[model samples]
Target chain A: MAELWELSAAALRAAIGRGEVSCHEVAQAHLDRCAALDPRVRAFVTLTPGTALAQADHWDAARARGEALPPLAGIPIALKDNFCTRGIRTTCSSKILGDWQPPYDATATRLVREAGCVLLGKTNLDEFAMGSSTENSGLFTTRNPWDLDRVPGGSSGGSAAAVAACMSPLATGSDTGGSIRQPAALCGVVGMKPTYGRVSRYGLVAFASSLDQIGPFARSVEDAALLLQALAVPDPLDSTSLPVEAPDYRAALTGDVRGLRIGVPREYFAEGVHETVRTAVRRALDLFCDLGATVEETSTPHAEYGLACYYIIAPAEASSNLARYDGVRYGIRADNARDVIGMFEETRDLGFGDEVKHRIMLGTYALSAGYYDAYYDKALRVRTLVKQDFERCWERYDVLVAPTSPEVAFRIGEKAGDPLAMKLSDICTIPVNMAGNCAISLPCGFQDGLPIGLQIIGKSLDEATVLRAAHAYEQAANWQPRVPSLSP
Target chain B: MPRLTLAEVEHVALLSRLRLTETEKQKLADDLNVILQQFDRLQAVDTREVPPTAHAMTLTNVFRADTARPSLPRAELLHGAPEARDEFFVVPRVVDTE
Candidate 1:
């Protein structure tokens, strides 16, 4: 029999529902796994054992009384530290908010809690989700479960690692630009970022208002769909939250891909992509072709401009959103400041990491009096061009397939000092966010002991089709994602 | 080629409400110039006829009833503040008392 911690979310939920396993037992197994494994992975920033046990016992008692349970009841999950979990300290992994507890829960947090998902812990991320590697975490870097020396691609690195290592069966992540998918690809799990405004961002600490989205990390496509179903409801808290009903994500995972149109964008296969990654994605496409899904090479000409447009727009929005962190409120305060201006400057300088500072500076320059039209405005227009490229593709194809990241995870400090190289790590994943569409990354192949991610993109608000294609691929490929301990 | 000078870097830092050391100014200027060269590529692409999109999804004013609703308790709201007294946030003086 499989250990409680090793069971898939669907299996565990059924076991708990059938009274074969108590929710308490399931929650305890995950907590014990975290206690044993977290010292090596550093995935969790804070573990909520008391709350998890209480919630588990609550579900167990309700089941004993023969009451109907909510979907995803009693499954242990990890929340990225950027989410505001009321009473749990939500550090966006920055020194400024190191111990500051949020007064309210992010809508996604509230919905998952309402669904009875046990809280395993809050996972680490890059400071304010600014970098591609977890090395940017002000608390500590979360290592790749596959290779401890390598990064679990970030800014949602800890969530990806936690799910990969069985620390949690499901975890939530936010993608500004490939924060979820890139890490999931590197860690050999499934990560999906829903269409923009698909998930409410009420209490979510914003990185880039236009590009940021909350998503899920699971080991299987079915599990990703289940978790997303719990999180995809519209909320009045976020005005940008889509007002329409969320399509039934889990029910749509029929795993039948007959006649599904899969488009392989040409630019995603161009130079700079590792041969192994390209080969893995192409093979995944071939597998789709065999499964009766048609595959064709298409062109999205503006994808190369995504990096430049993203850097400009994301930072500009980040600079504005992060301005609220000034010392007058809930964050760290600098001592020995003579005035409010000095206080603000000193506290921010002391609080933010180098990456955060760099972005803030870039944004400040771009939004300044003389440079707004040249930098911020130009990026916005180019952003339209990037979106139009995808719009054109959607007119012809139901889904676009590519390698989630150009390369697999790199060593922790390999690109830490070189900004450009680090930024390039997310080149393949950033374009989807630029267009405000939906994308999912799943393990397609392995290279030298590291797993490769194949990305499937869908039209805006069409996560159902994306999951269907990925589910078909996962079922046909018959690949069981490898746990770190099983790795060669 | 230097795109952003040290003085410009410092000015940008001031606008960002962050203070940088002399060494930081030097390093950030170099980093900013590197990043700016990429942004400059946008100049080559003609966007004269393109209208900017602030969001990916089409959104309109979301209206909820104007009825009064219970809010978070004042004490609880103030609890997360760095320093608070009598339900008010404490901060450095804003006025010139000299």
Candidate 2:
């Protein structure tokens, strides 16, 4: 019998269809794994064990009764706490929301539930997905599965850590900048950030709503693609969600990369990138070239401006999005207040973390009356150039390639004091979000025993190409077999 | 480069609605100064004629249908409130006499 957790979603569905393994047994095995590993890692905030088991039993009975099931039948998936799960405490990893239980599921969460994905639990995140290291999680910092002391890259760190540790085969992650990809890279798992608006953000707590996107973190490119397929339905509740037919993302993996034009931005190879990361990226590129794809050098002139522009825009949007969390509406409220403003101040002051406050303040400054033209408006203009640069390249190349992060995962608290260094860590991934394109971070290779990711970026709604290219590279490199030995 | 004073840091924090401790205020002032020094570097670029972009690459007007929708039910929506009277969440009033 196939070990339940080791089987891919495709294989699991097949086994369930063939009656080799019942959905209940598979889910139970995953739950058992979660029980075994989650305590040390602190990957989850809530595990609805009964709900997951009941859902699996429902699927199992349906299968036993000759009922046709959905594509993701019996697949166990975890959700980032930011994606509200009805009746589950969706804290977004902040004390403000510590006791808040969302009454309605986010659009994507509901869709995943309807697809028969067993909800294992809600994973931890950076308070409001603001920080890079899961260390910023207000509840508990999730440790990297590869090395316990190290961080699993944040906001989506818990999701990445859980998937990497085999606590769950798949999990939902939201990326604004590199939240999904960076952590996935650090954790040695597959993280996909679909083109902005490709997945519904209806249920996702607002974090720079313009750039925030829902994607997947999984053990493999194919598994990530499967999660995307299930989650990509256009949600009407999210006005920004694009109305388009979801692609057969898994099927797109069949085609070869022959004649495909892959561009390596000349600027990406320059200053500040670590040597090992560059080497891993080059090796991945070499693998693509060996697969008959043509590798060419290109430049996005405004790429260097991505970080500065992102800092302004993301914080500005975040400030606006987070303004909803006033003392009254939702989340924690101060016990006693002399006045409404005092209550607001007390609630928010106690609720948000330092980084969150810093961004909100910076954003508020940028959008302030005198500074709007000099900052936010100027950043928007720079944003135009960056997008144009991507368009020009895509017109010539099928996809763009680069190292997902500048370096391998730094130890937890390494850059905590130096916010600028932490901000620069997201340099490469930020531009993709700015341009609203899709990107994937796959385990290219490792640096000093820690994994590095090679990024494959695609045009908008072009998740198939992103997945295809990453899948091809994953297969060519066979990085799947090199899963970190976590049993020790 | 703009040097942020302790008072300026306090003002910014006030605008940000954060109640910073004395140490936090001191630390943020220094950090903000360094951050501003970096922002000053961007001034070298002659963006006099450049238009700032908020959304860089993809198509705009990624829209959904404009239709009336029912509001969230009163009770369920406000379930997490720490203090509430009737359907409304109660808080101290914002505008007040000092």
Candidate 3:
């Protein structure tokens, strides 16, 4: 029998709701798994076994009283470190906020609690969600569960790794330029980034306000949908949160893709994609065609400009958003500084890691007095072109298909010194964020013993089609049952 | 390609209020130059009539109702402060004496 920790969130929810298992038992199973695996995986920044058990007991007690249970009651879920959890440390994996705890919960956190989900702990990430690898974490790098020497693709790396290793069945991740999808792809899990504004960003540590979005990582597409259902409520606190009613993401997973139009963007396959990844994605596309979906080559001309546009735009926004982290209001303050300027400089200099500093410098330069038009404005115009490119592509096709990342997970420290090389891993995923569309990355096949991700992207707010196609492929691909082998 | 000199990096760091070590400043200069050079590709695409997209959503001016609601208590809000003094954040003096 599969261990309780390895069960899908949907399965656990059903078991808990049917009274087949107590919530405390489920929480204990996962806590024991974490205690056994976390030393090697290092997926969590902090573990909340005590709180998890207590919450689970509360659910069990409520069940004894014949109270109605929420959809996700008693499911142990992990939050990416960037999401603020009241009275729990929300570090964004940065040294600056390392010891700081939030005074209130993020909208997503509050929603999960309201649904009676047990909080496992906060997972690790790139400091301030900045890098492609969790190596940029001010704490420590989370190893890929498939291969500890290699990195779990990053920013959301720890969350993906946690789910992949069965440390948690469902976890929340924020994607700004493929943070969630790439890591999910690399770790052999299901990760979906809902349309920008589909989920509220209230209380999420802002890396780039316009681009950042919270989503879920799970072992299966249906489990991902289950978590998304709990998190998809509109929030009044976030101005960008869409007021549109969320569809039944779980109900939409019919596992049928017949007559679905899949567009294969020529730009996604042009160069840099590894041969193994290309083969796996191409095979997956062929399977879609075999399943009665028509696949056609489509053009997205400005797709090549996505990374450049994102780097410019995200950092420009980050430069403004991160200005609040000065020594005054919250977070670590440099004690030796004599004046305000010195304090701000010293505090940030000590608090932020290298990648954060690099982006801040780039953003500062891009948004500076003289270069604003030449850099930031130009990037925004290119952003419009990129969006238009997708809009035109969507006119002909229902959804686009592409490789989630160009290659399998690289060894840790391989691209650590090269920023451009690390940025290249996000090539396929950034354009989706740029267009404010929904996309999902699922394990299509294994390349050289490592998993490859196939990305299915949908039009703005059209997560149903994306999820449907992904579910169909996932059901046919039969890759969901595979788990990483971690030897103690 | 525009070269980001060490001096310019220092200037940007100052603008960003980040105190970088000499090594980080040099590394950042090279990294920024490489990234800026890559961004130079945007200049080739003629966006003559294309308006800039500042955000992904089309909704503009999202205003909430003007009704008073309870907010975080003063103590709660101040709890995360690095240093607090009697319900207020403590900061270094901004004014300088000649």
lDDT of 2 by residue, A1-488 (tens): 55788777778878888888888888999999889888888899888899899999999888888899998889999999999888888999998886798888899899888888999999999989998887777788998888888889887999999898888889999999899999998899999999887898998999988789999988889889888998999776776777798979989997488888999997787799988889889888888999999999899988888888888888889888888777777788877768776777788888988888888877877787777777787777778778889999988998999988898878878887886988887888998998899999989887778888888999998889888888988887986444567765
Worst 10 residues of 1 chain A by lDDT: A479-488
How many angstroms is residue A232 displaced in model 1 relative to the true structure, after the best TM-score fit?
Answer: 0.6
> Which of 2 and 3 is the better model by TM-score?
3
Tens-place lDDT per residue, model 3, A1-488, is: 56899899988988887778899999999999999999999999999998999999999999999999888889999999999999898899988985788888999999999988899999999999998879999999999999999999889999999999999999999999999999999999999999999999999999999899999999999999988888889899999999988999877988888899999998999779998898899999999999999999989999999999999999999999999889777779999998888999999988998898888888988999888998888899999999999899888899999999999999999996777999999999999998899999999999777999999999988998999999999998797347888865
Model 1 per-residue lDDT tens digits across residues A371-425: 8889888998998999999999998899999999999989989985666888998
lDDT of each: 0.91, 0.85, 0.92
Clashes of each: 0, 12, 0
| Candidate number that wins on lDDT, 2 or 3 | 3
* DockQ list for all candidates: 0.82, 0.57, 0.84
Q: How high is the DockQ of candidate 2? A: 0.57
Scored against the true structure, residue A371 in model 3 reaches a CA lDDT of 89
| Candidate 2: residue A92 Cα off by (Å) | 0.6
